[model samples]
Target: MITNGMIAPVNLTANVNNLNQLQNKATPAEAAESFASFLKNALDSVAAQEQNVHKVNDQFIIGEANVNDVMIASSKAELSLALTSQVRNKVIEAYQEIMRTQL
Candidate 1:
Protein backbone atom coordinates (compact mmCIF):
# COMPACT_ATOMS: atom_id res chain seq x y z
CA MET A 1 0.00 0.00 0.00
CA ILE A 2 1.07 3.59 -0.58
CA THR A 3 1.59 5.28 2.72
CA ASN A 4 3.13 8.56 3.73
CA GLY A 5 6.92 9.02 4.05
CA MET A 6 7.94 5.54 3.00
CA ILE A 7 8.51 3.55 -0.15
CA ALA A 8 7.01 0.10 -0.42
CA PRO A 9 5.90 -2.21 -3.17
CA VAL A 10 2.38 -1.46 -4.30
CA ASN A 11 -0.22 -4.18 -4.47
CA LEU A 12 -1.55 -3.60 -7.94
CA THR A 13 -4.42 -6.01 -7.47
CA ALA A 14 -5.70 -4.13 -4.46
CA ASN A 15 -5.27 -0.82 -6.21
CA VAL A 16 -7.14 -2.00 -9.27
CA ASN A 17 -9.96 -3.29 -7.10
CA ASN A 18 -10.21 0.06 -5.34
CA LEU A 19 -10.19 1.88 -8.66
CA ASN A 20 -12.97 -0.33 -9.94
CA GLN A 21 -15.02 0.40 -6.86
CA LEU A 22 -14.53 4.12 -7.38
CA GLN A 23 -15.53 3.87 -11.01
CA ASN A 24 -18.67 1.97 -10.11
CA LYS A 25 -19.71 4.27 -7.28
CA ALA A 26 -18.74 7.74 -8.37
CA THR A 27 -21.07 9.90 -10.45
CA PRO A 28 -19.75 12.31 -13.02
CA ALA A 29 -20.18 15.20 -10.61
CA GLU A 30 -18.34 13.33 -7.88
CA ALA A 31 -15.59 12.45 -10.33
CA ALA A 32 -15.26 16.08 -11.39
CA GLU A 33 -15.11 17.20 -7.78
CA SER A 34 -12.50 14.59 -7.02
CA PHE A 35 -10.41 15.66 -9.99
CA ALA A 36 -10.61 19.30 -8.98
CA SER A 37 -9.56 18.54 -5.42
CA PHE A 38 -6.72 16.39 -6.69
CA LEU A 39 -5.46 19.20 -8.93
CA LYS A 40 -5.69 21.68 -6.06
CA ASN A 41 -3.78 19.38 -3.74
CA ALA A 42 -1.07 18.76 -6.34
CA LEU A 43 -0.63 22.48 -6.96
CA ASP A 44 -0.48 23.08 -3.23
CA SER A 45 2.20 20.42 -2.88
CA VAL A 46 4.25 22.01 -5.66
CA ALA A 47 3.94 25.41 -4.01
CA ALA A 48 4.98 23.96 -0.68
CA GLN A 49 8.07 22.41 -2.24
CA GLU A 50 9.02 25.75 -3.78
CA GLN A 51 8.61 27.42 -0.42
CA ASN A 52 10.73 24.72 1.19
CA VAL A 53 13.54 25.44 -1.25
CA HIS A 54 13.51 29.08 -0.23
CA LYS A 55 13.45 28.17 3.44
CA VAL A 56 16.32 25.74 3.01
CA ASN A 57 18.38 28.33 1.14
CA ASP A 58 17.79 30.84 3.91
CA GLN A 59 18.88 28.34 6.53
CA PHE A 60 21.95 27.45 4.51
CA ILE A 61 22.92 31.13 4.35
CA ILE A 62 22.87 31.17 8.17
CA GLY A 63 24.82 27.85 8.31
CA GLU A 64 21.91 26.03 9.81
CA ALA A 65 21.24 23.93 6.68
CA ASN A 66 23.87 22.28 4.56
CA VAL A 67 24.51 22.74 0.84
CA ASN A 68 23.26 19.20 0.24
CA ASP A 69 19.93 19.94 1.91
CA VAL A 70 19.53 23.13 -0.06
CA MET A 71 20.42 21.44 -3.31
CA ILE A 72 18.00 18.57 -2.67
CA ALA A 73 15.19 20.94 -1.76
CA SER A 74 15.83 23.01 -4.89
CA SER A 75 15.85 19.91 -7.04
CA LYS A 76 12.62 18.64 -5.52
CA ALA A 77 10.92 21.99 -6.11
CA GLU A 78 12.16 22.15 -9.71
CA LEU A 79 11.02 18.62 -10.48
CA SER A 80 7.57 19.18 -8.97
CA LEU A 81 7.06 22.34 -11.00
CA ALA A 82 8.19 20.62 -14.17
CA LEU A 83 5.85 17.70 -13.54
CA THR A 84 2.93 20.07 -12.95
CA SER A 85 3.69 21.90 -16.20
CA GLN A 86 3.81 18.64 -18.12
CA VAL A 87 0.51 17.47 -16.64
CA ARG A 88 -1.10 20.76 -17.61
CA ASN A 89 0.22 20.40 -21.15
CA LYS A 90 -1.12 16.86 -21.42
CA VAL A 91 -4.54 17.86 -20.11
CA ILE A 92 -4.76 20.67 -22.65
CA GLU A 93 -3.71 18.36 -25.42
CA ALA A 94 -6.35 15.83 -24.44
CA TYR A 95 -9.04 18.49 -24.39
CA GLN A 96 -8.00 19.74 -27.80
CA GLU A 97 -8.08 16.22 -29.15
CA ILE A 98 -11.58 15.70 -27.81
CA MET A 99 -12.75 18.97 -29.35
CA ARG A 100 -11.35 18.01 -32.71
CA THR A 101 -13.30 14.75 -32.79
CA GLN A 102 -15.91 14.85 -35.58
CA LEU A 103 -18.65 13.21 -33.56
Candidate 2:
Protein backbone atom coordinates (compact mmCIF):
# COMPACT_ATOMS: atom_id res chain seq x y z
CA MET A 1 0.00 0.00 0.00
CA ILE A 2 1.14 3.53 -0.71
CA THR A 3 1.44 5.78 2.30
CA ASN A 4 0.50 9.45 2.35
CA GLY A 5 3.26 11.85 1.19
CA MET A 6 5.30 8.90 -0.04
CA ILE A 7 7.31 9.10 -3.21
CA ALA A 8 8.10 6.01 -5.22
CA PRO A 9 11.72 5.49 -6.09
CA VAL A 10 12.67 5.49 -9.74
CA ASN A 11 15.69 4.29 -11.70
CA LEU A 12 16.61 7.42 -13.62
CA THR A 13 19.08 5.74 -15.96
CA ALA A 14 16.57 3.07 -16.93
CA ASN A 15 13.92 5.72 -17.53
CA VAL A 16 16.33 7.73 -19.68
CA ASN A 17 17.24 4.64 -21.69
CA ASN A 18 13.57 3.77 -22.19
CA LEU A 19 12.76 7.30 -23.33
CA ASN A 20 15.72 7.38 -25.69
CA GLN A 21 14.64 4.09 -27.20
CA LEU A 22 11.16 5.40 -27.74
CA GLN A 23 12.43 8.61 -29.29
CA ASN A 24 14.68 6.70 -31.64
CA LYS A 25 12.04 4.12 -32.60
CA ALA A 26 8.85 6.16 -32.85
CA THR A 27 8.16 8.32 -35.89
CA PRO A 28 6.63 11.80 -35.61
CA ALA A 29 3.42 10.63 -37.26
CA GLU A 30 3.08 7.78 -34.80
CA ALA A 31 3.59 10.13 -31.86
CA ALA A 32 1.02 12.54 -33.22
CA GLU A 33 -1.50 9.73 -33.73
CA SER A 34 -0.89 8.44 -30.21
CA PHE A 35 -1.40 11.86 -28.71
CA ALA A 36 -4.57 12.35 -30.73
CA SER A 37 -5.93 9.03 -29.54
CA PHE A 38 -5.17 9.91 -25.91
CA LEU A 39 -6.80 13.32 -26.25
CA LYS A 40 -9.91 11.79 -27.82
CA ASN A 41 -10.22 9.30 -24.97
CA ALA A 42 -9.92 12.07 -22.41
CA LEU A 43 -12.60 14.08 -24.18
CA ASP A 44 -14.88 11.05 -24.31
CA SER A 45 -14.45 10.49 -20.58
CA VAL A 46 -15.36 14.10 -19.85
CA ALA A 47 -18.40 13.87 -22.08
CA ALA A 48 -19.45 10.68 -20.33
CA GLN A 49 -19.21 12.37 -16.94
CA GLU A 50 -21.22 15.32 -18.18
CA GLN A 51 -23.90 12.98 -19.51
CA ASN A 52 -23.95 11.13 -16.20
CA VAL A 53 -24.47 14.40 -14.33
CA HIS A 54 -27.35 15.27 -16.62
CA LYS A 55 -28.90 11.88 -16.01
CA VAL A 56 -28.54 12.25 -12.24
CA ASN A 57 -30.04 15.73 -12.41
CA ASP A 58 -33.02 14.42 -14.32
CA GLN A 59 -33.45 11.61 -11.86
CA PHE A 60 -33.34 14.04 -8.97
CA ILE A 61 -36.00 16.17 -10.61
CA ILE A 62 -38.16 13.09 -10.90
CA GLY A 63 -37.54 12.25 -7.22
CA GLU A 64 -35.53 9.14 -8.05
CA ALA A 65 -32.11 10.46 -6.97
CA ASN A 66 -31.10 12.03 -3.69
CA VAL A 67 -29.62 15.56 -3.44
CA ASN A 68 -26.25 14.08 -2.48
CA ASP A 69 -26.05 11.97 -5.62
CA VAL A 70 -26.96 14.96 -7.78
CA MET A 71 -24.34 17.11 -6.08
CA ILE A 72 -21.61 14.46 -6.50
CA ALA A 73 -22.41 13.94 -10.12
CA SER A 74 -22.40 17.68 -10.83
CA SER A 75 -19.11 18.11 -9.02
CA LYS A 76 -17.53 15.23 -10.96
CA ALA A 77 -18.72 16.74 -14.25
CA GLU A 78 -17.36 20.16 -13.30
CA LEU A 79 -13.99 18.71 -12.32
CA SER A 80 -13.74 16.70 -15.52
CA LEU A 81 -14.46 19.84 -17.58
CA ALA A 82 -11.86 21.80 -15.64
CA LEU A 83 -9.26 19.06 -16.18
CA THR A 84 -10.02 18.91 -19.90
CA SER A 85 -9.67 22.69 -20.21
CA GLN A 86 -6.36 22.63 -18.39
CA VAL A 87 -5.04 19.84 -20.58
CA ARG A 88 -6.09 21.70 -23.75
CA ASN A 89 -4.44 24.88 -22.53
CA LYS A 90 -1.24 22.98 -21.79
CA VAL A 91 -1.21 21.36 -25.23
CA ILE A 92 -1.69 24.78 -26.86
CA GLU A 93 1.14 26.16 -24.80
CA ALA A 94 3.41 23.33 -25.87
CA TYR A 95 2.51 23.86 -29.52
CA GLN A 96 3.27 27.56 -29.25
CA GLU A 97 6.59 26.82 -27.61
CA ILE A 98 7.54 24.40 -30.37
CA MET A 99 6.62 26.99 -33.00
CA ARG A 100 9.01 29.49 -31.36
CA THR A 101 11.97 27.08 -31.56
CA GLN A 102 14.67 28.10 -34.05
CA LEU A 103 15.23 24.57 -35.36
Candidate 3:
Protein backbone atom coordinates (compact mmCIF):
# COMPACT_ATOMS: atom_id res chain seq x y z
CA MET A 1 0.00 0.00 0.00
CA ILE A 2 2.78 2.45 -0.81
CA THR A 3 1.67 5.79 -2.18
CA ASN A 4 3.83 8.33 -3.99
CA GLY A 5 7.02 6.42 -3.19
CA MET A 6 6.25 6.61 0.51
CA ILE A 7 5.20 3.67 2.66
CA ALA A 8 2.50 4.17 5.25
CA PRO A 9 3.29 3.28 8.83
CA VAL A 10 1.25 0.59 10.53
CA ASN A 11 0.16 0.73 14.15
CA LEU A 12 0.80 -2.81 15.33
CA THR A 13 1.40 -2.29 19.03
CA ALA A 14 -0.61 -4.78 21.08
CA ASN A 15 -1.46 -4.33 24.75
CA VAL A 16 0.05 -7.39 26.34
CA ASN A 17 -2.30 -7.07 29.33
CA ASN A 18 -5.40 -6.83 27.13
CA LEU A 19 -5.18 -9.80 24.84
CA ASN A 20 -8.95 -10.31 24.80
CA GLN A 21 -9.55 -6.76 23.55
CA LEU A 22 -7.53 -7.42 20.41
CA GLN A 23 -10.26 -9.60 18.94
CA ASN A 24 -12.68 -6.69 19.06
CA LYS A 25 -10.53 -4.49 16.85
CA ALA A 26 -11.84 -6.05 13.67
CA THR A 27 -14.93 -8.18 13.17
CA PRO A 28 -14.57 -11.46 11.29
CA ALA A 29 -17.05 -10.31 8.64
CA GLU A 30 -15.15 -7.08 8.05
CA ALA A 31 -11.83 -8.89 7.84
CA ALA A 32 -13.28 -11.43 5.43
CA GLU A 33 -14.78 -8.77 3.21
CA SER A 34 -11.55 -6.81 3.01
CA PHE A 35 -9.45 -9.91 2.36
CA ALA A 36 -11.85 -11.16 -0.30
CA SER A 37 -11.87 -7.81 -2.04
CA PHE A 38 -8.07 -7.63 -1.99
CA LEU A 39 -7.72 -11.15 -3.40
CA LYS A 40 -10.26 -10.48 -6.13
CA ASN A 41 -8.43 -7.34 -7.18
CA ALA A 42 -5.08 -9.14 -7.25
CA LEU A 43 -6.45 -12.02 -9.30
CA ASP A 44 -8.13 -9.62 -11.69
CA SER A 45 -4.86 -7.75 -12.20
CA VAL A 46 -3.03 -10.97 -12.97
CA ALA A 47 -5.70 -12.03 -15.42
CA ALA A 48 -5.51 -8.67 -17.14
CA GLN A 49 -1.74 -8.99 -17.48
CA GLU A 50 -2.14 -12.43 -19.05
CA GLN A 51 -4.71 -11.05 -21.48
CA ASN A 52 -2.32 -8.26 -22.36
CA VAL A 53 0.36 -10.78 -23.16
CA HIS A 54 -1.97 -12.65 -25.44
CA LYS A 55 -3.00 -9.44 -27.19
CA VAL A 56 0.63 -8.43 -27.64
CA ASN A 57 1.50 -11.82 -29.02
CA ASP A 58 -1.33 -11.61 -31.51
CA GLN A 59 -0.25 -8.12 -32.52
CA PHE A 60 3.28 -9.35 -33.07
CA ILE A 61 1.96 -12.10 -35.30
CA ILE A 62 0.18 -9.46 -37.39
CA GLY A 63 3.35 -7.33 -37.64
CA GLU A 64 1.68 -4.55 -35.65
CA ALA A 65 3.84 -5.08 -32.55
CA ASN A 66 7.49 -5.87 -32.04
CA VAL A 67 9.14 -8.79 -30.26
CA ASN A 68 10.16 -6.46 -27.41
CA ASP A 69 6.54 -5.63 -26.58
CA VAL A 70 5.53 -9.29 -26.65
CA MET A 71 8.49 -10.29 -24.51
CA ILE A 72 7.81 -7.54 -21.95
CA ALA A 73 4.16 -8.50 -21.67
CA SER A 74 5.01 -12.18 -21.33
CA SER A 75 7.55 -11.43 -18.61
CA LYS A 76 5.10 -9.27 -16.66
CA ALA A 77 2.43 -11.97 -16.84
CA GLU A 78 4.88 -14.64 -15.75
CA LEU A 79 6.12 -12.60 -12.80
CA SER A 80 2.61 -11.72 -11.66
CA LEU A 81 1.49 -15.36 -11.76
CA ALA A 82 4.57 -16.43 -9.85
CA LEU A 83 3.94 -13.77 -7.20
CA THR A 84 0.30 -14.87 -6.88
CA SER A 85 1.35 -18.48 -6.42
CA GLN A 86 3.83 -17.54 -3.69
CA VAL A 87 1.22 -15.48 -1.88
CA ARG A 88 -1.23 -18.39 -2.05
CA ASN A 89 1.37 -20.72 -0.60
CA LYS A 90 2.10 -18.32 2.25
CA VAL A 91 -1.60 -17.92 3.03
CA ILE A 92 -2.06 -21.69 3.16
CA GLU A 93 0.92 -22.03 5.44
CA ALA A 94 -0.39 -19.34 7.78
CA TYR A 95 -3.84 -20.97 7.92
CA GLN A 96 -2.31 -24.31 8.76
CA GLU A 97 -0.23 -22.75 11.50
CA ILE A 98 -3.27 -21.08 12.96
CA MET A 99 -5.15 -24.35 12.93
CA ARG A 100 -2.34 -25.99 14.89
CA THR A 101 -2.54 -23.47 17.75
CA GLN A 102 -3.67 -24.91 21.08
CA LEU A 103 -6.84 -23.57 22.57
Residue-level lDDT of model 3, residues 1-103, one tens digit each, is: 5321111222224222234443554787765665566567668778887888888788889898787777777877888899889999999999999999999
Task: Please give, for residues 1-103, the per-residue lDDT of candidate 2 as tens digits.
Answer: 4321211222237434544554554588876665566556667767777887788788889998788777777777787789778978998999999999997
Backbone collisions counted per model: 0, 0, 0
Clashing pairs in 3: none
What value does the lDDT take at residue 58 in candidate 3? 86
RMSD of 3: 9.3
My TM-score estimates for the predictions, one after another, are 0.76, 0.69, 0.71
Model 2: runs farther than 4 Å from truth?
1-27
Residue range 1-103, candidate 1, lDDT tens digits:
3342211222337434544555665588876665566567667777777877787788889888787777777877787789889988999999999999997
In the order shown, the candidates' Cα RMSDs to the true structure are 5.5, 8.8, 9.3
What C-alpha lDDT do the candidate models reach, one value each?
Answer: 0.69, 0.67, 0.68
Lowest lDDT 10-mer window, candidate 1?
Answer: 2-11
Q: How does candidate 2 fare on TM-score?
A: 0.69
